[model samples]
Target chain A: MSRVRVHNFSVSLDGYGTGEGQSMEAPFGHAGERLHSWFFETRTFHQMQGRPGGGTGADDALASAWGPGIGAEIMGRNKFGPQRGPWQDEEWKGWWGPDPVFRTPVFVLTHHPRPSVEMAGGTTFHFVDATPQEVLRMAREAAGDRDVRIGGGPSTIRQFLAADLIDHLHVVLVPIVLGRGERLWDGLEELEARFPSVESVTTPSGVTHLTFARP
Target chain B: MSRVRVHNFSVSLDGYGTGEGQSMEAPFGHAGERLHSWFFETRTFHQMQGRPGGGTGADDALASAWGPGIGAEIMGRNKFGPQRGPWQDEEWKGWWGPDPVFRTPVFVLTHHPRPSVEMAGGTTFHFVDATPQEVLRMAREAAGDRDVRIGGGPSTIRQFLAADLIDHLHVVLVPIVLGRGERLWDGLEELEARFPSVESVTTPSGVTHLTFARP
Candidate 1:
């Protein structure tokens, strides 16, 4: 089945998912950069940046699992950038420069619509203005046998989680606390019922790994 | 074995663990309240708050796992409260009230030294002015066989994480974007090397249950 998964999401101990007052310079925002210290140094991340001779380790192993068979991706407009309303200029790309990390068909859930953006790599950004269900249908169709990964900024993932559309999730619990900022799961539990099982691993590099699956 | 563990810490996705401004109203500073949504409504949380009847699903299960079996806790002065400088008032308990959640001996890492505070519950607040290692020794002795939980605002967890002292951590990836706020992990990857493998679950309630343990 084409399951929807949230992989390698980073969070703070104080509970906020993203930091406050994110600017163009600090897209993740103030302390937000601290969340992914584990993944950024991984061999997989180095490889993605086109660096050679960098490969496998515990961190690399986990990083290597990031995006492979993920046929499509779902993200909020914020993850793409801070621009609201309509996509005025075509010059705005993601924080990752030209070629983004997700090299698949990326579906961005936005209130505004724009033409598809084809990058140098296999990535093609698609803007969808419908409900989460409509976005999921399109993503699933684009995904095929592969999984559909939800790229975050928090709100996007919360919508999918609220609808029970995600199948599994992988979170990297960095040992820092954002005393303030955006949260990952705000009022989600207040909305409905839930059942989830979790398993975990702690690595030597100060990163703890966790997986959540439905029983 | 008294392994170091980072517990109940929250951070912003932008890399900030806490905001710059410190005040009672903005406890965590600006949007800081968003980080702790997960722990507030869980069955374990309710049990701690002396309440009854909460969602008993995986999210609740994860919530219950956060506050049990820790012999000691370490926190920064910022986490202890917005009160700075010296010990002015004897009646300044934490924001959690007289009977705090952590019923064990709590160590506050700070430059200022204050006498231990014996609360209504089994919780005792001990202020330490020495280094993190010094505090760790005290907490370890206090913890015995149980894990030594590093409880903090952000800088505290970062210091511990950089020292490679944390063994297990569970960072709940809440789904909200601050756009601007404190970040969790900013520049610590060069000091440590680990990737997180995750265990996760999505409750119909919208909160995703994620677990991470250091191996």
Candidate 2:
């Protein structure tokens, strides 16, 4: 069976996956670029932007883990764009510009579904109103032999985690204290039991890579 | 001025300082020594329990930092014992038995104040119902020229942190998730500004020692 994996998901010291009051101007709200600065400086992120030259340290190695083996991606609408509750503008082609980095079928969860948008690169956004199980089924079908990735805005990942749909989880624990924001581990108490084997490594950049997996 | 400090404070990956259902039998509740396992293996903790021979690594070095600091210690009532609402037993001389670990004046915050208890060692338990600021003043006075330590039960540390009384904070980030319990970070949003300088080092034991100091 193909695995359901989450990779390089960053969170603050206080457990906030993303800062509060997210908007178009500040998608991470009060958090700014603090949550993802590690990824942004990495070669993996630079490569994603189709750029050259980036950090070649432990951080880059962990950040690079996000791409491989991921076939299809399941994301919340918030990650697709800042618009909430019945899309404000049809022209909003996501924060990733005309050519999104996701070079696969992206299943976005939304209350008000819209027609699919085929972007440059191999990316195609499919907005759908479906449960985590239903969406996972669709993503798994689309993923084929490769693994399905759970792209997060926190809530989507929490729902899938609660449903026990995830097989491998990779979280980057950033040292900065966000104080207030959307938490990744709110309702999932004793979440370690689901994935018995866990490993952690902290890089020189002061971020710890926590990987939880089932054997 | 006597500096206020907290050291070796253990918190889970999800930010829980302690676990739920705390009692006399289970001091750390369902967490069950999981949070303090790093400390337990450290030579500092072994020396605290009057034992010898523990891991002589980075964890031990950081654990040893809890001592040496300065004088008096202020803590929440919960850290003293499990009993609540005006205390259950007068015979209960705290969890430390006859001779407590804290050799300095220990001020315990409680609603119902009681007469001070002089233990076998130099340790003295002073129960007072004072605000964080007021307690800090008292602790500073008791500490004299030496620094004052802010012992925690999460809430105690949070209170001191809110009052901007702590000069040094050392938090041990344990790689476990306790879904419920008192959180140390709660309302301390943008707390990073208070401490201008911060440093972190991950030990071989997989625990990160995060130090925030006003430099």
Candidate 3:
């Protein structure tokens, strides 16, 4: 069966998935790259940037697994770009330039639906205005035999999590505390009951990898 | 120099120290004993209850470190009892019966201060209406050569942490997520900057122990 998974999603020690004041200039706001610095140092991230010589530790091991079984991804509008309201210009592709990391069918949840964008590589951006369940259905269909990944900017993850759509959730707990931002765990009361099998491992980079999987 | 430490403070994956709706019946509020269940299974906790045997693994090892070298404890009023507003009756000596786990001087912070109550053990509950600094000074004086522990119910920990008074902070990350509760890391922005050295180890009981210490 195809699974809905969240992989290598980094959050602050205070549970902020991304800091406030997110803009094109600062995607992670005041948080900057601090939340994902651990991943940035990983071999997997370096490979994504078409670079060489990156750390090959436990952080890389977990980060490398993010793209394997993922055939499709569902991300929020905020993640696609920092634009709000409607689509001002059609030329804006994404933060990842021409070839996005996700070489799969991508569903972007937004109120202002736009035409499907065919980017370089296998990544295709499909703008849709639907519920989390609706988007999951579309993503699952696109995923086929493979799994669907819930790409997050915090709110997107919380919506999917609130709907109980996630099967395997991998969270990297960064040591920094953002204090204020989009919290991933908000309104997710008693979320642990869904995921019975919990595992945690600390990487050399001072981040703890926590996995919550359904039994 | 005497170090101010926080040991074996358990929080949910969402960083909630305790659950909502705290009352006399439910000391930990809706969270109940869920947050501290890992610590409760430890041999150190069993010994606190005067039990025969308990697991002496990593969980117990960390839990056992809570009492030693701690001459005094500063806890929030919420930790003392469920009674709010003015103390209805001075007879209400705390949830702990005749003898309490704290064998040292315990300062309970409250706006409505009352007379000191001496329990069976060396535990003496002193109600004080003072700032975190004032209380820390009092606790430091009481502790003398020994270290002072910040016994928390979350908000109290935040107070000391905000004041930049804690030297060593030990946190046990429980897998559960209590959706609504008083979070521990609300206003502690970039708290990890203070603690340069961080160590994490997963116990056999399925809880990750994270310790942050000042250099």
Candidate 4:
């Protein structure tokens, strides 16, 4: 079955997905790279950098799981870049270079929609000012037989979680206190009840991979 | 030199140390036994019940670690009982019958200080309206050479954390989402900076024991 999954979504011990004061230079704001330090040590992350020789550990194993079975992704506008409100001009393509990490059609949720931008490689950014359901429908269509992924910046994932749209959620619980930032678990109290199957694996790198999947 | 330590402090994935709507029936509020189910499976909890055998896993080892090398305990009024504001009467000794978990002296943090009550076994309850520092002084006196444990109910832990009174913190991260409850990490931003050392171990019971210690 084609399931909607969220993979390798990192959060601090305090539950903040990203830190305060996010900007172009700091996509994750004050959180810096602390939330994703574990990811950086993974082979998948090394491969993303077009480099080699990264840690082949439990973290790498869990992190690399995101690529398989995923066909398309849906991310918030902020995830595409640090730009907010009306697209300041079409100058900013995205945080990714010519070729992005996701080699599939990606739907960018925004209040103010813009023309679709096709980049190098298989990645193409489609802007949509739609609800989680509508965006998911478009992503699922683009996904075809494969599964759709909710590539988050916290709020986007929360919307899907609140709507009970996600089938598999892989949260990488990083051991840090971000203090202030976007919280992933707000409003959706007892979201675990929706996903009966829960599992946790703490790697030696000090990150706990917590997975909640619907049976 | 004796240190102020906190051990076996269980919290939901959403950072709630205790659940909402706490009463005599539901001490952990709506969270109920979901948070402490891992503890029940531990050998320590079994020993407390005078049972012979229990799961001798990482959960058991970590849960049992709470008692050792500790003397006097300082807990929030809520952790002791559900009674709030001024005490109705001294009839409520505690949730534990004759002998409570803490064999050492236990100090209850409250605005309304009451006369000390000595119970069966070595456990003694002393109600104090003093600040964290003042209480620490009294607890140190009571503890003598042994360490002092910061027994918590989220708000009390937060108060001690805010005051930088806790030296070592061992938090049992239970895999549950208590949407609304007392948040332990609130206002204590970047607390990991104070504790230079951090380690995590996830048990098969889907609980992660996160320990933060000072260098």
lDDT of 1 at A88: 74
Chain A TM-score, each candidate: 0.90, 0.98, 0.98, 0.98
Question: Candidates' DockQ values?
Answer: 0.06, 0.68, 0.73, 0.83
Q: Return whichever of 3 and 4 wins on DockQ.
A: 4
Tell me, by lDDT, which candidate is best.
4
Compose the digit string of candidate 2's lDDT tens values, residues B18-133: 99899989988989998999989988878878997999999988888777967999999999999999765888889987888899999999998988999987899999998998
**lDDT per residue as tens, model 3, A1-215:** 89989999999878899989989899999999999999989899898999998999888999998999899999999888889997788799899978888999999999999999998899999999999999999998999999999999799999999889999999988877898889998888888778878888887887888898984
lDDT of 3 at B206: 75
Interface RMSD of each: 9.6, 1.4, 1.3, 0.8
Residue-wise lDDT of candidate 4 within B1-215, one digit each (tens)? 79999988999888999898999999999999988998888789988877788999888887888888998999999999999899997889889888887899999999988999999889999999999999999999999999999989899999999999888999999888889889999898888888889999988888999999984
Which candidate, 1 or 2, would have the higher lDDT against the true structure? Answer: 2
Best by DockQ: 4
Clashing pairs in 3: A189-B179
Q: What level of docking quality does candidate 4 show?
A: high
| Predicted model with the maximum TM-score | 4
Return whichever of 1 and 3 wins on TM-score: 3
Write model 4 residue lDDT over A127-210, tens digit each, in one string: 999999999989999999999999998999999999999999999998888889999999988888888899999998989999
Instruction: Kindly list the per-residue Cα lDDT of model 1 for residues B81-181, writing each as its tens digit.
Output: 88888767757878788889888899998788878889988899998887788889899898888878887777788787766677776555544434454
